[model samples]
Target chain A: MPGPGEFELIREYFTSRFQTGSRSGTADNGVELGIGDDCALLLPPAGKRLATSVDTLVADVHFPAGGDPYRIASRALRVNLSDLAAMNAEPLWFTLALTLPHSDPAWLEPFARGLAETAHEFGITLVGGDTTKGPLSITIQVTGACARPLRRDGASAGDIIYVSNQLGAAAAALPVVLGEVTVSPRQQQQAETAYYAPEPQFAVARAVEGYASAALDISDGLLADLGHICDASQLGAELNLDQLPVAVLAHSLQADAAVETALTGGDDYQLCFTVPARHRDAVQALQLPITPIGHLSEEPGIRCQWHGKPWQPRGTGYQHF
Target chain B: MPGPGEFELIREYFTSRFQTGSRSGTADNGVELGIGDDCALLLPPAGKRLATSVDTLVADVHFPAGGDPYRIASRALRVNLSDLAAMNAEPLWFTLALTLPHSDPAWLEPFARGLAETAHEFGITLVGGDTTKGPLSITIQVTGACARPLRRDGASAGDIIYVSNQLGAAAAALPVVLGEVTVSPRQQQQAETAYYAPEPQFAVARAVEGYASAALDISDGLLADLGHICDASQLGAELNLDQLPVAVLAHSLQADAAVETALTGGDDYQLCFTVPARHRDAVQALQLPITPIGHLSEEPGIRCQWHGKPWQPRGTGYQHF
Candidate 1:
């Protein structure tokens, strides 16, 4: 419902930059019709199911209300793409529903640039989007193609748990990102990079697809998300806290605080997955940057141990409400 | 990041009511996995293309902020489904991204019930959703299957344009809907019903699938939406204003005002489509309750004639910006 001039601006900044795949007459991108239509037409790849996820980021609630639009756009998309990675789905097409307080080219240009760059980097196409007037929030729905899907209900007792790369970087970076703390310039750069662009583990997902018993991306902290796998699979988990990969930025804190942040802080977007004992060797041979931090058990709850003593984190995860 | 209790509340109200299709263990629904997962897995029906659309409706901007949640939910979904109807698509699966001011059961209960009822009426399943803390708004992404798509760029110079059903009801009802005007209780009922539940033209879309050269739903009034067809098809439109099927509610106004409302009013949710001359007989034979209001022309802009004299409406359409 943007006015003529604002509509033109949207077309120029967003639609023009994403004029590839179906919109540009490409035959292999799965998009039959993209933007500038009532609905985007898509042909899902034959013999593969479509994996789809939706996430919304609200200004002030999820991220700073008037922060750098470029970084905000990057984080919004990367976090959503992480959902596809957890499902072992190869990214295909996505639709965006964006609500803005106003149409300002200064803010939009960088945001669209960041979005286009991320879409290109991930090899995904923007198929459709809606722009509305309101408080700033982004709702993105990502669709992907998957032959073998890793689901949360597939894990069994004794399955070995793994987390890709590391955790707590984004959590530790939040204070700096929010301008609440001062740090070295190099550390500031690292904080912004980790918070704004947590990489989606598509490669790890592909490697673990057929082998992992269950998988999910960590959004609401490791222990909290691990609890989801437990509830879904009707099992429990036992974590080795000493072996946890607390992120480098988090290492700036005290040893126990770093470990606690890795356990309970949110927004890391790493992949938390479980593999059966039989596939541990296979997954290990893949040599992906993953760590064996825990194992599923029949204890019916999540438990942690450090130096042969039981450990407990202060809070479980960030709560939305 | 809802707390355990709030998550339980969400699961009870929203998820429990939508326990059908894939989640209910029905293999024919094309849903491999539904809610309570990192992503929803779907198998698109063979030999059909997927048509998807996303729309976000903000409280106060799109509707009364504290109005009936049931009516709001109904209007939100219906408007989005109309996009699928414009593409000649049959309803399949959908995802919801909901932002709420707070987790109030009073609002969530009716909202979920209304959404469930509407989804049942339209035969669409809720496959995925994201709930976040923010200002109230609902973004629904609907996907459907279509054998043949109705596009905006297929109209020819001699194509006859038609509108399914009547227009101006929702626009004329806005005053009563917002409680800014006084009217009879029956009139108020009619007004609310028209505004809240504008029927999606699925049947009309099916009837015109093979015959309509170009099609789009009229959310931004006849002149504006038809201008889109003109722009895309590289043609103009000539309308016979006397033939417009203005709504009953709008007829209560003065003649010219009513006609103007029908021409420029938004939220009708009716479809304006074009059929080539060759398909006129076949389309007329379908016996739909549609009126031939206009035709495409070689000229480059929209023109209107009233009583054989040139005419112009005051405003072209609603502007979001």
Candidate 2:
């Protein structure tokens, strides 16, 4: 009658749904205990290592404060899933710590639905979570199983860099997401899809698992994330701007502007990985959607080349502070 | 020069400390990869189930917004560790999703040290985390290893209930913590320690592992949390108020007030467990710091008895929303 209290809200929206859902046979899925417990008990696959990552999306900082609850949920989970993919892991179980401003059923309904659908899609189960009252934010911790886990420090000087699919659509979609730009209905839909549902590169990760020596998901733009691989491996990289696979939405902008967006746009959720020369043929034989965009070098800093000439972007990447 | 960007801040405060510290041999400890990666890779103990839980503590709602960062970090991690103890799990690894209003080194320094010390104290490792910009909040997800887990659904009607250590100190310390009341230096220190450094009942959990039927950490309150065990096990409980191990700080209040606080005040982080009559002698023989508070009954609701007379407290526990 009073829209339920904290426990009731969790029960009605998350616990009941997850318990009765198709994936409720938790023991069969390595979950010995799940929701409605102090802690969820899980059994990681026998010989495989567990790959775990955590990410937090705060209202206004990560997304619009009053954005669509469904989309927000989708983005938050997917963004975290990307990290597992980067590690070349298979999706397993996840925990969500959701802090909300109030117990609004309107917000809870769609958010729960979105999370359930996404979890089902990714073959991940919502094992356990804590829901509290505070400023809206979602902290998702995902654990997966990996046999041949990809890491960011295995790259060598002769390794080539590649990225899955395209980039910059999510960054370009910001204008539309924030209502700063008016666009055609089709463009709006595309922008929303790109922004809310950027696919994690699980398939690419699997395709390049044995071949890729270093990898990470691009959440802080290509240059920034590539810098991570370089820093970890003690190497640098040289990007081939002509080989960049810019998203169509970003292509709508001026030529250089599109390249800048492709170079420095965060939230792409694309995999950026490195493969040694010996594994190049093997990786290419898989016919994956990934494109070779750069090459790790012994140099200590990132360099850019446009059509064989030296180049530099206007800025680096998104800054949290 | 610029107070370090996000990456540099993380490296300077967290990564460098954790890497060069005594726990750097991650592989020997089952952490294949720790911080500075897409994900933390871990190998769960050979035949043990993994118990995991997540908790989000917000500024103002959970604690004072501008409180000492060191104690805040300690409380956040210890609170999550309590869940592991409740499940009879040994602390393993944890991830922190910290949302800060800004990247202030002064705040980060103490917080990281506090977290590192707590991790060392609990024999846990800091696996991975995401630091972002937002209203100050800390979301901690802890994973532990367990052979025989204690679950709330295992209790039977005839099981005797017990609580570890003491209760009501944390709740009573709130006034002192918030500066609403003043006391002697020793009292103030005791209040702060009770409020901030709640010892997760891992020892108690281990002692009762084979004998206890069910258990959980007393977070919301003795009455409310025991209600959880009741709802899960489909049984009720009659709390013997006279038997409660009222905390020393709480004893400063009136007799009834101390009992009431011990009954309904929360944040004690003590374990409440049930054991069948058959295991009573074995448990008592262990001589653990536990007191028999009540017993499970065939009834459907929680009942309280104060010196053989029914009693009701003014409030149940802390309400989140």
Candidate 3:
């Protein structure tokens, strides 16, 4: 008998039947050549700079092994799409390099399904990639187009900082996944949904396009990620403790614990961005769920304030070492 | 104390010191934004389709775990560069999604050195990607430019099939690497060199440009790779068994073993391209060790012949199960 081959596996699980995003809407059929070739060809929209990024997810490191393969697949694709969102780029296409120990259709069917669903939802077309024999790992590369690319170093000292949504739900879900804590089924489902299918803030990114100066998706907790923006923009941030959008499920923890999680909870795929003081009223008038959590300043390091007084902190969540 | 953190590690080892492949030479400075950004930006040359390919290399699957980190890094970058060569595209920039058990400078310095060396040699710049904790694997995504991109589906009946160099040296080197065989010091070095670093046929690809109808680099063995071309082009191939360019190390094996190894052995990293009858003279005139081992035909599958007698093959090559 023939080997359980690469092409056969791709054809069985990763082809047109598994296509997620609808190509008819906004995506131009930019795929000149796709799978079954030496390399895939893509036509970048005329006169637009191409924005490309890559992210890899490994079992037991990024997620628990033996977890829901469908959700795992979705997290991998969406996080990379989050990078496209961070750049304020219109989503174009993606390629996935998947390495697995075995070609079990049981795992692949739902995995491919989730991948397709996320792709279609994000309007991302699958271009090409390679699958090979190895430990369970996925590396997703996404490319998009942008004219006025928002960068992380463009924030001025007087800019106001904002985050798109509430924080810490995914980080709060980890204890439930590890069975260290119990939650009501509804809360568990909510946390798991946040953990598995991260909203990449693509719509929020578009809404803030020219108005936002420096931006990044909050992946490494609010503190560490804002520290990143501070490092890039050569400025610091001052956060008002009372203004943070704390998630409902995290509120179940001790008061201090809940506030800590909200402040430093990683895996919140919300946009953290800055707008100059001159544009504050204009940005606030947009009337989106944009929260004014902090302000960029000429200070040297993060200064957290509680009830208008200096508040000391412990650690930011999920520092990848 | 701070964690042996991701951003710190990147700043210490993977910064400008690791920039390889001079943009001043043949490589145009296509990088509009690079390593520090959310997504690196590139201005693709006008009227050119962007050719993108991704390849992942895993330790103990693609290479031994404890081998030299530098050589392993070089191999990972080069094999992906081979894909760009196959498509006959000019190198632009690449993003690397690298996973590691931990960040150790001893391993990373040499690894970054090797990565930079190969990047400079290929004239490709490092763009944006993520580093996370996981089993060690490297996924490289390369994008290049080509006006008339070479593909596998354009071969015609009566087209001549050519390969860039001798085959099976890397596959032949496997046993030596695994301690299954012994050879002279010189022979061991020769085999190891081929195994650790397979040369991509970039110059040969340039020579055959606009003349070759369909092209691919032989990562899988000659028979298997040619079969891929035939499958894509909806044609068959007739190869002269005696005409196979078996490398000296592989040639040293027994008659049947040598033939089987030459036919089925993989990791050759040689170019297999098809040229129309009309452009045969133009292609051959370039004269860079061009070898006519076969011809595309109207049949449906690959047919190997020796001295006008049909040869029954053992198997095509390594099939990734």
**Residue B163 accuracy (lDDT) in model 2:** 95
Task: Point out the worst 10-residue segment of candidate 1 chain A by lDDT.
Answer: A20-29
For B1-321, candidate 3 gives per-residue lDDT tens digits of 434689888877776654432222223456766787778877888888888899888888888878788888898888888999999888888888888888888888898899889888888888767788888888888888877677888889999999888887888888876667898888778877888898888889888887998999888888889888998888999999788888888876334487778778888789999999898788778878768888999999999898889998888887778
- lDDT accuracy of residue A54 in candidate 2: 97
In model 3, pairs of residues that clash are A20-A120, A21-A120, B21-B120
- Native-to-model Cα distance after best TM-score fit, residue B55 in candidate 1, in Å: 0.3
Residue A267's lDDT within candidate 1 is: 92
> Candidate 3 at residue A102, lDDT?
83
* Candidate 3 chain A, run of 10 with poorest lDDT: A18-27
* Interface Cα RMSD of candidate 2: 0.9
Score every model by TM-score: 0.97, 0.97, 0.95
Q: What is the lDDT of residue A136 in candidate 3?
A: 91
| Candidate 3 docking class | medium
CA lDDT scores, all candidates in order: 0.89, 0.89, 0.83
Q: Candidates' interface RMSDs, in order?
A: 1.9, 0.9, 1.5
Instruction: List model 2 lDDT by residue over A1-321, tens digit each.
Output: 355788998899999867622223346459878898899989888999899999999998899888899999999999999999999999999998999988999989999999999999999999899999998999999999999889888899989999989989889888888888898899889888988998999999998888888999999999999999999889999899999999989987334599899999999999999999998888988999999998999999899999899999998898887
Per-residue error for B231 in candidate 3, Å, reads 0.9
